[model samples]
Target: MTTNDNPATRSDRNVERAGKLDTATLSDALDKLGINGQCYKVKARSTDFRLAGRAWTIKYGPAANPPGTVGDYIDDVPEGAVIVLDNGGREDATVWGDILTEIAHRRGIAGTVINGICRDVALCLKLGYPIFSRDHWMRTGKDRVQVEATNIPVNIGEARVQPGDILRGDADGVIVIPHEHEDAVLEAAETIHHAEEAIREACRGGMRLDEARKQFKYHQLQTRGK
Candidate 1:
């Protein structure tokens, strides 16, 4: 079939492709990408966050009135794909809980992120599920509700993620890569990482903040191939 003949087919192919990246690789991609909501910062004490092949999403909803069971939307839990949910930034009702977390892992999903809240903390931690949520809550989602139009666009915090957009999380926070800019972002992140590292080294060597900043200007300059 010609490319123009089957649009849906192409999209499915893309989702399949994006789901294959490992948690570490995705994180590195985002660390390199470096664009997320101002509040998209990580707060967990020690998550070691890396969720690879679990792709799912939700829309912004209310805690006073959340959507439904998120399990239904998770059709394909590609090994190492992290489940990315955007609960309209609510910090009360949990869109994901322990049972869902366990299932994702069993299905081979790498990790999960709730732009809202979650429950069953003990179970999640025990299951070794790497989850990053805004806070912890004990509310059930029976009447709440869920929304996942598989491989569709969803927003988390202020970051826009398309169907195949790469999602990554670390102790620092989550960073998303627009599918179109994945490779470019990855390359930029590498350049950024190196720049930050040099600055760190300078600081360790007893350089003051201003001195380190000035020295790193050269490193930053190099990122632009200057």
Candidate 2:
């Protein structure tokens, strides 16, 4: 839940706060805030893997006549940044694989997320590097797909994410918090988390489930704000 002060900013502070929370809580916060950041259909490689960091977005498109490359941008990803690859949800080709995983891990990269698929699943799993994606395959994306842009807005499982946006991922899924709304989202998420904890405490104390929920206003936990 801690972040280095290398380039600390308000968003970074909020990211650290959001990191302590699960995707479910942050997803509820996004709902309450009316932000469409819940990445539907995308999932983590393992439930045990978790990721939280600023996003370094990459957008991909079909290769041209001369063909294009897949993951050459990994060299530019900053330490602790989450590499988000937007491959248009293609499950046939993979933009990530064993080499990228090894290099990213060595560089202290937080994790990676993809709208398409990834190869070398066994290496990522063994290294315990978090990778959230729509699916996984062995096919290379080298000639099939090419990097159109980097540090730009990209789609991940229908969720549009911009560079520097806070990305929180866990067993539930990934959610992006726009830099401008990080403060509000973090605050709202913490409130929801605390309320849920209170409900748990009440239930553990023998209170009826219905009573516990009512006491904490569980029904309105995800209601949008004015």
Best by lDDT: 2
Candidate lDDT (C-alpha), each: 0.57, 0.87
Instruction: Summing lDDT over every window of 10 consecutive residues in candidate 2, give the lowest-scoring window.
Output: 1-10
Write candidate 2's Cα lDDT for 161-213 as tens digits: 98788999999999999888989899999999999999999999999999999
Question: Which whole-number lDDT from 0 to 100 does residue 109 have in model 1?
Answer: 69
Model 1: worst 10 consecutive residues (lDDT sum): 1-10
lDDT of 2: 0.87
Per-candidate TM equals 0.69, 0.94
Q: Residue 66 of candidate 2: its Cα lDDT?
A: 97
Cα-based RMSD of candidate 2? 4.3
TM-score, cand. 2 vs. native: 0.94
| Total clashes in model 2, counting residue pairs 3 or more apart in sequence or in different chains | 0
- Clash number for every model? 16, 0
